[model samples]
Target: MSRKLAKEISWLLVTIALLTMFSPHTADALTITTTRKLVVLDPGHGGKDTGISSTTGILEKRIVLKLARMTSKLLSDQYRSLLTRTTDTDLSETDRATFANQNKADLFLSLHLHAGKNKGFFFYFDTPDNTPATNETTWKTQGLIHRDKNRQTAELFAKNSQTRNKKVKTHFAPAPVISLEGLQMTAILTEPFTITDIPGTAAEQDAFLAPYAKTLARCIETYFENKF
Candidate 1:
């Protein structure tokens, strides 16, 4: 009600307007529109912690990172795509989940590979913790609140992959103790992308991930269109 207070508030508003008009991050800020859902892709393992390997010396960490980037590129035009780790570096499971939550992600996905044969895609949805967190209000239980949506999203992708000639098996795989804990969005993790499935060679990775990501992008689009 005081004139001094009114003048200060008006000055603040004018300053904010000027900053909004001239800030370099204006475009970046605008990209965070509500109309487009945000998807966070997490490539599991990095640095010294190489997940798995094959006879050809293909590292699981390397391949999954590339796959995450490829998939993000495919999804970029339709939705906001981001990755937890952009390079070959070690990122903790907690940090990855925090990144997704901080970004207010609409969906979260983790990519990993295993040392095994090509047994289709191992898709995962979050499950309740074996020993559920005592504090229900904590972030650790966020996945439990969104568990149904997470499972449905996993199923949607799995069904779509089958149509694309990729065999996908859906399972309730993660607990709060694992990578997907405390995510406040629909989450899925694809596992054990074998060397046989996506070989060590760049040529093989590209060949496998291109079509794989294409189908994945389409599946994500479908999920957003129908569900969100």
Candidate 2:
């Protein structure tokens, strides 16, 4: 073999050896390429549970479902938005929490429509039970680790949704009161507006839901920004 060809072969062998010594598949080389957060949107009440009733015949279940869909669409580009129910169906609170936990959602937002003479936003966070024992087997027994994170997210939603013209209220309750038990992630429930107390025609409810959905999307974005 020619000396030049032999030298080239030696160089190639050295390069291959170096690459084998410094492979990119090492644990330290691994990184998270996707930063998009996973958000679960649960539209409360469905089927037999019509929730609140409006004078114009708008049902709370239908309105909340619409808002959840729109909010999911708005956050599609920034986050992985998943809805617990896509249609009119009854889902138990346990089932809802299990869905969120199974999907490993980063946050849970239960969308609701209030049935009262008030027009305000109410954000509710989970008040979990006793802390789980520090054992691998009991990790899923309680949500104490996530309580602070849940409260922070819920507070951010309230702050972001509140404006000079609109005020957002917050409520703290146990898991039974808000149906947020069994969740392993940050959880929040939002009652954006009331259908029973709309100031305009029934058709105007759509318009109301539009901006409310946008506000929710914005709040979610803000929450993640501060979180990371």
Candidate 3:
């Protein structure tokens, strides 16, 4: 080949290689950072386990399930987020934690209702020591609870209590076995309302619970934006 022709062919090959290297296909394969956050909502007690029952016949499981659905809707509308359990089916505690971890959740909230001869909202968390007995005692005594690392975050929600008769308490419990093995932020179990067997508290419980759900949703949103 002529020297001039050889030079032109070599330049053409170099241009083609450069074009292939910078093509959209290559760019599409590059990893990109994600800013989206995910939260897992676990509505506790379902199926055969109806949870606590109120004098008015409202089941604890039902109330929490409804509240969870509402919270999921609010999160989706406000933050375009995700949820762990979106229905009234049974989910093992361990399974719930696994789902949250697998999804790379930023937060894991287990929603439940308090039951007894009393009424109020309560939040639960695992103790630093991971001892079940010690954790139960701590909760019974303080009513406001969590691991040392999560105390500040727990107090933020506890202080926002709006019930006239209900007081917010923080207490520690053994870390849920499911959360022990995974990457997750604080796993909070909230008793936003109560389903008491006590008389005359039924209507009161219903009245307090509906608004409580709304407030809790706001608190969660604020917590993530400001703290986590």
Candidate 4:
């Protein structure tokens, strides 16, 4: 063989060996390319913030926490779910959004309950700022930028709720609340139902929440599907 041909063959062999050495790293990158979406669920009120309490011994903080837990469990199969507070603890609205932003969540949901005889859901999303973004747009107003996505998610949940319970009233509107303020990711505040009319024992409340949690989880799954 010619010396020139032998030199070319030697260079090709070296290139192949180098690629083989780096192939493991390439495989690792590919494996992590499509990560599961992370969702941050904030159960409203805790600790001294008992929220609404009834003479019957039920508390709003405890009610929402259980809903958050059930929702998180339902989402476990296809996504990463986290709660701002696991146990009864103090967690401010700002702190909840900060937790979601720090974790780079794809979506943030602030769950809540209210005291009313009406059985209905209220979905609130921040109004979109048509004003161009500026230096003033800090985390304090970060939610303004994601207002469109927030509204979309809110509508989705509202539609899903109606589908699950056609008789139940559900509304989605651009009324930003303290619980949904200062979020860097798409966020929604939902008072899924009023506790005043939940009826029956705590165990019956759990039964009511189970199907509702499934609805929440299904909507989240549909969101990620559309996102990707």
Candidate 5:
């Protein structure tokens, strides 16, 4: 071939090679493989803080502890799980969140029995600033996504409660700091039932709460399954 023709052929080859090298098919794209997530359960109030008292002398702390244990057991048997406080021990709210974060828990559940004359289960989600521990940066960096997932899980719990005639009420903390440190963690404060100071509420409380442990377990399972 003539020199000019050879040069042109070489340039065409180089151009084609460069195009192939930078082609979309040859580019590296991000791949996200979501695995099943482990969750942490925080049973509120312990040893020293008896929490609210029922007319029958049943303590809120004790009820929650029992329920938490049951839920943890069920989760362990059925799915991935962890517990922040397994026994009758007092744990600060911040500590609980820290533990969950340290463990890289996909979800955080703070369990408690209600008092103050409430009748049914109440599910509380964190607001942006309910606790002193919450701040703008934390909320923006970590709180938003966590809070959204928590709300999603809580809503699922509410929907599942319909099977037992138990109703769930979802409340957002008025301020970010009202519950725990709102920014660093995504947490749910679940008051399954009230150990009231009133009569005839004991049986009602049990009826409401007995299925809660199982229901919560199911919710966690479902959440992680869908998440992964």
Candidate 6:
């Protein structure tokens, strides 16, 4: 691995190591899987629906696209991945979920940047399903089953990222379950950082995003490592 990639993985492993030190039993219980996983990175609000803007005039749509690409690169070694949108084209929420479902992705990560005063990562898993299944079929129940895995994956991300961001004084909320329709596989929505909360010049803003991209990649690695 390149130095940059090593640093990213190191950032995550150090935290995982520390956590294991404190909770060896829990760590011991985790089942590591060697099977390759497929991750779908959904960059939110493309084209006309630019999500949020930065103080330095950066657009949220652009930021997320770059982040998704970076995260995908860091994760390429261990997992097969695809992006929901390659360019600035508007896609509906249902369409995004449908794409992941159609592709049979192992995990769906919907990327977004929140516009707020507080800084840090926030994650949400799919909430309980109220929508009835299309038919009494196995595929219809797939979404419901994936919902549980989504919550587990979200918590893994929260735990790992919270430890990594502690020194930076960043905060992470407890991953909440939220309603998202049309997903047939595990999914999580992530707001890694606030758009307006970024620091430094236009060029320096990328530095702010670098750690986040790596951190998210690490979280994905951690999830697959523990999830068989």
Best by lDDT: 4
- Measure candidate 5: CA RMSD: 13.5
Give candidates' CA RMSD values in order: 5.0, 9.6, 11.0, 9.1, 13.5, 14.5
Error of 1 at 34 (Å): 4.1
Residue 225, candidate 5: Cα error in Å is 2.0
Task: Provide the TM-score for each candidate, comma-separated.
Answer: 0.79, 0.72, 0.62, 0.80, 0.65, 0.70
lDDT of 2 by residue, 1-228 (tens): 999999999999999888867886642333332456888999999989988878877788888898999898887465778999999999998888889989888888898877654444444433345444343534343355566676666667766676522544544343533456567777777787767655455467667777888988888877777773
Q: Distance (Å) between predicted and true CA of 35, model 3?
A: 2.1
What are the lDDT scores of the predictions, listed in order?
Answer: 0.74, 0.72, 0.59, 0.80, 0.63, 0.73
What is the overall TM-score of model 2 with all chains considered together? Answer: 0.72
The lDDT-based order of candidates, best leading, equals 4, 1, 6, 2, 5, 3
lDDT of 4 at 50: 88
Candidate 4 lDDT at 179 equals: 70
lDDT of 6 by residue, 1-228 (tens): 899999999999999889888996765555333245888999998989998887677788988998898899888476778999989999987788778888878888888888765555545442253443445534434455555566667677777877777643344333433323456776777787778866656567678778888899998888777873
lDDT of 3 by residue, 70-170 (tens): 67666634353455556667767667767876777666677777663343443445535555334345222221233553445555566554432255443
Comparing 1 with 2 on lDDT, the higher-scoring candidate is 1
Off by over 4 Å in 1: 1-13, 18-34, 121-137, 166-177
Candidate 6 segments whose C-alpha is farther than 4 A from its true place: 1-35, 125-143, 167-179, 199-202
* 1-228: candidate 4 lDDT, tens digit per residue: 999999999999999889878799876765664487888989999999988877677888998899999999998466889999999999888789889989989988888887765455555555465444355776666767776777788888898887887666788888747777687788888787877756468799899889778888888888888882
lDDT of 6: 0.73
Clashing pairs in 1: 114-192
The Cα error of candidate 4 at residue 27, in Å, is 7.7
Clashing pairs in 2: none
TM-score of 6: 0.70
